[model samples]
Target chain A: MIVYLLCLLLFCVGLYCILRKRNIIKIIVGVIIAEYAVNLLFILVAYRRGGRAPLHSPDAVIENMVDALPQALVLTSIVISLASTALLIAIAMRIYQKYRTFDITKIRELRG
Target chain B: MNYFAGMIPFFVVLALGGAFLVSLAGRRLKIFPDIAGLLTTFSLLLLSVLAVIAVSGGGLLVYSIGAWRPPVGINFVLDGLAAFMLVTVNLIAFLVSLYAVNYMERYTDKWKFYTLFLLMLGGMNGVIITGDMFNLFVYLEIASIASYALVAFGTEKHELEAAFKYAVMSTVGSLFILMGIVFLYSYTSTLNMAHMALVLAQRGTSNILLMVSILFIMGFGLKAALVPFHAWLPDAHPSAPAPISAMLSGVLIKSLGVYALCRVFYNVIGINPALSSVFLVLGTLSMLIGVFLAIGQWDLKRLLAYHSISQIGYVILGLGLGTPLGIVGGLFHLFNHSVFKSLLFLNSGSVEYATGTRDLNKMGGLIKKMPVTGRTNLVASMSIAGIPPFNGFWSKLIIIIAAVQAQEFFYAFWAVLASILTLASFMKVTKYCYFGRLKEKLKGVKEVPVCMKVSMSLLAIICILGGLLILPRGESLFLGKAGYSLLKGTSYGNEVFEEVNK
Candidate 1:
């Protein structure tokens, strides 16, 4: 329970940085933080008290293995976040090149 | 039956294959990307129509990967709903790609655009067809990332800024969805949506389920641009190239946001009174506020983007009623919105193509110089405004009637009020953009190319004929069948399992 609460706290920190920070790079870091927190939480949820490593071998007993599904899911989720992060960074670089600054408040060409 | 069963996975393969193939072949041949992209989307359109037929004949079809039975391996399940969404997505994709062939020449690399376009198409198709929750997330990210890149395709100041804002907000939304899925997986010990539905039904509702629902509402709502979560859309949609703007507004949000919401809530989470009221409130708020904000926009595409929010609210409102008529109306409205909205965006793209401006006040009497674009724009404007004989009217009327039948008088009244507001704003669009004497800056404009003209005309014809979908035969074949699947709700799990066993 405490660990889960910590995970939530980490996610909130990321959200706070994302909502409050004015730097584009900082917001990207915040996204990374929040994303890793979710990944950590997914891993945390699948941990078992007496779990053995989940590997399939001919002579090894496979009892009480921690749920391996979420581990695989988290790996895939990490890859996806990597792709998005790369794309985000690419866009941020272009934005910086165009605006010549990283402050988001200074970039206000698009507005209602 | 077996052949149709085999066609399910090909939707994903063909789209993804087309994406990579375009990238490879486009380097050698200048026109190869155009041909490959067109053939790919045209084939996709054909497959989705066949998919509808497949569903119409058989009840449900589940394609288990590697012959692994469901509940363990990834699965692609196609029913009336998936087929409906596929047809909607691919139909617009084909037309938009057709328009892009000519419109994209103004950009530097046409192949990159087509590659990302096909990748996005594949992602949307996968989202509609996949049965696993994690697979859905994967596909959702694929689509979202592609759209982010497409939004910044021009890489101009405004485009880059819009893309970054959209990417961050959408990534956060995707994380929320992922977090929800993780909790669900932990709770049920399964990732398959159908199996999870079974488990959820057995376990009944819990506080965790409530949390998941709220998370989803935020996640998908942001994707769908539901009012408060809608800050990214007006910037993102208008920033993309016109055909891309059309695609984003037309089908991406519907598949990623609306369809996912319906599938999860109605099927997996099992709809309840509290959830229903939540949908009603959110849907109503999005409808009124979106239109309210739209009227103030001078950017034509931005205004259409806001209308997307208003129109999607109608869809959610109808689906939330949880009645057969309401579901049908919502589903019908969804289909109609995709058609007319794509047309409106395409028309906007054509206008931009011709006059080199999206500002309504910058041009006038476009009806004389660019007759095709102006006329089609008028048709689309009427359709979106819910004028008689156009497709939007029938669906809006159905939703309004359904709302009254469900005795949600306030919502029904708002729906009507929004429709009227839609008319008033569109009239502003016509008066400023199409009607009156030609503006000084627009004197040299001409009609668009043949491909664009053909696609826009086809979409307008569909808009005018869209109401026919509500007829008995058409309804039973497509809209009614799709609505029926949603009406099945939690039985969706039982149906998938039954089909898999067979």
Candidate 2:
């Protein structure tokens, strides 16, 4: 239960950073943080009390192994997160080159 | 014999292959990307047609990966809903690819555009077809990330800013979805959607499911550009090039946002009283707020983007009514919106192509020089404004009728008022841009290229005849089946599993 609470706290922290931060790079970091928190939560969900890995063997019995699905899912999610992070950074770099600032308020050429 | 239904992966493989081949040859051989892109989309068009036929005749087709049967292995389920969505996704995809062929000449790396475009298509297809929860999340990310890159494809000042905002909001939304998936997997200990639906049914409605549903609403609602979470759309949709603008507004949001929401709410999680009320509120909110926001915009694409929010609200409102007639109306609106909205965006692209500007204030009397573009824009504008005999009017009429039939008269009134507002705004569009005196600076502008004209004409024809889709014969194969799938709701799970076991 504490772990779940911690996960929520971490998520809230990331949300704060994203919502409140004016710096583009900080927002990117916030996204990364939020992504990791969710990935952590995903892995945590698959955790079990002394559950063996989802593998079968005729001769040997395995006990107390971690749930492998979320681990596998997390790896894939991490790669996707990495792709987004890289793309975000690249776009930020371009924005900086054009606008000469990372402050989002200063980059307001587009409006309704 | 039914087990060989595992050919689902081939679509993704083909799209990925097209991406690779385009990137490899795009630098040295421009013709290669054109042929490859066109051929790829054409094949997808054919595949979507086959899928439609298969769904109309068969009940549901489940394709398990690696011959690993469901409840254990990953499965791709193609039912009427998936098939309907596939046709919409790929049909627009093929059109956008065709438009991009001529429109992308001004941009530098045509290959990168096609690559991201194909990737996004592949992601959407994966999302629509996958029958597992985690797989859906992964595919959603794939599509979302690719779209983020595509939005920034221009690398301009505004493009980067919009892409940055889009990436942050979308990633945040994805996190929420992932969190929901985590919670759902934890609660049910199953990834297969049918099996999860059975488990959820067995457990009945719980607080946890309600929480998951709220999380999903926030997540997919952000994608769908619902009223509260719609800050990124006006900026993001207008930032991309025109064909892309069309694709993003035309079908991407519908597929990723609205379609996913309906599937999860209706089929996987099973709709309930609280969730139904939630949809009602959100749908109404988006409808009222979106049109009001759009009424004041002068930027053509931005106005269209806001209208997208408003139109999506209509779709949601219709679906949330939860009657068979309402579901059919919503699905029909979905189809009509794709047709006219894409046509409108393509017309905007042609305007931009000719005038090098998207500001409505700068364009006037363009109908004289660009007759094809102007006439098509007129058709699209009329449809969007819900004029009689066009596609949009029938759908909006059906929705209003459905609301009234369901005794949601207040919603029906709002729908009527919003439709009037739409007509007023679009009237402003046509009067200022197409009918006024010819501008001094735009005297010699000619019609767009043959390719652009051809694509725009094709879409315009559809928009004009779109009312025919609701006719008895047309509805039977297309709209009827799609609506039936949604109306069936959780029974969809039984249908898919039964087909799988066959």
Candidate 3:
């Protein structure tokens, strides 16, 4: 229960960074943090007390095993976050080249 | 299995292969990208028509991946709703690609454009058909990433800025959706949507289900550009290249946002009165606020972008009513909006092509110089504004009537108010952009290329005739079945499982 609360804390921290930071790079990091928090929560949800790896072997008895599905899913989720981060960074780089600033306040060319 | 059933996975495969092949050979062959794009989209359109026919025969088609049965492995399910979305998506894709052949010449990397366009198409088709929750996320990410890159394709200051904002907001939305999926998986221990639905029905509602619903509403609401989460759309839609703008506004939002939301809420999680009321309030807010904001915009494409939000409000409002007539009106309006909105965007693209300006006040009397674009724009404006004899009118009327019948007279009044405001704003568009005396500097502007003219006219013709889709004969094949599927709600689980067992 405490660990779940801690995960929620981490997510809140990331959201705070995103909503409060003016630096584009900081916001990207915040996004990364939030994504990692969710991924961690997923992994934690799959964990079981006194569980071993989900594997099969001859002459070995399987008593308790952690869920393996979420481990696989988390791996895919990490890959997707990597792609999104890469694209976000690339766009940030171009934005820097054009606006010559890391501050989002300075990048206000598009508005109503 | 029917031969048509075998064609399900090909929608993704063909588009994915075409994207790769275009990227591979387009450098050497100048015309390869154009031909490959047109062919791939045309074929997908043909397959979607067949899908509609297959569904009209009154059975769901389930294709188990690797021959692994459901509740164990990933699968693709096709029903009335999927077929409806497929047809709408692929039709816009084909027409938009047709327009891109000419409009994209102004850009440097035409091959890259085709590659990303086809990739986005593949992702959307995957999202529409996939039956696994995680697979939907994968495909949704694919589509979102492609669109982010496409929005920044120009790499200009405003383009990069808009793309950056769009990317950040959309990525956050995806993470929310992923988190929701994780909660659901932990609850049901199954990823297959049909199986999950069955489990959820057995387990009944819980607090976690409530949490997941809120997460999904926030996530898909951002993607759909509901009023509260709509900051990214006005910037992102107009920043992309024109054909892309049309594609984004026309079909991308509907498929990824609206379609996914409906499938998950109505089918997997099941809707309650509370949820329906939430949808109703949100829809009403978006409808009024979106049109109010739109009437003040002077940028041609930006105005159209805001209208996308207002129009989507109508769709959500109809679906929120949760009645047969309401769903029918919503689905019909979804199709009609795709037609005319794409036409409007394409018409904007054509005007920009010849005049090199998207400012409504910068030029006037384009009807004399660019007759096709001018006339098509007029038709689109009328259709979106809900003038009589056009498709928008019939759908809006249905929604209003449905709202009244549902005894939600307040919502019905707001819908009518929005429709009148829409007409007023569009009249402002025509008065400022098309009807005044030809500006001296714009006198040299000529009609757009043949391909663009053809595509715009095609969409305009659809706009004029789109009302017929809700007529008795056409409704049974298209709109009626789609609405019936939604009306079935959580019984969607029973239907899919039955089809799978067969």
Tens digits of lDDT, candidate 3, B1-502: 6567678999899999999999999988999999999999999999999999998986789988898999898999999999999999999999999999999999998999999999999999999999999999999999999999999999999899999999999998998899899999999999999999999999999999999999999999988998899999999999999999999999999999999999999989998999999889998998999999999999999999999999999999999999899989998899999999999999888989999999988978988888899899999999999999999999999999999999999999999999999999999888888889999899789899999999999999999999998889999999998998888888888888888787
Q: List the residue pairs that clash in candidate 1.
A: none
> Which residue segments of model 3 deviate by more than 4 Å?
none
The DockQ of each candidate is: 0.94, 0.83, 0.90
Best by DockQ: 1
lDDT to native, each model: 0.93, 0.88, 0.93
lDDT of 2 by residue, B120-216 (tens): 8888888888899989988898889989999998898889889989999999988888888898989998888888988888898888997899899
2 or 3, greater by DockQ: 3
Candidate 3 TM-score to native: 0.99
Question: Which candidate number maximizes lDDT?
Answer: 3
**Candidate 2: residue B173 Cα off by (Å):** 0.7
Better of 1 and 2 by DockQ: 1
Number of residue pairs clashing in candidate 1, backbone atoms closer than 3 angstroms, sequence gap of 3 or more or interchain: 0
Question: Could you give the C-alpha RMSD of every candidate to the true structure, in order shown?
Answer: 1.1, 1.4, 0.8
- Lowest summed lDDT window (length 10), candidate 2 chain B: B1-10
Ranking by TM-score: 3, 1, 2
Regions of candidate 2 where Cα sits further than 4 Å from its true position: A50-65, B1-7
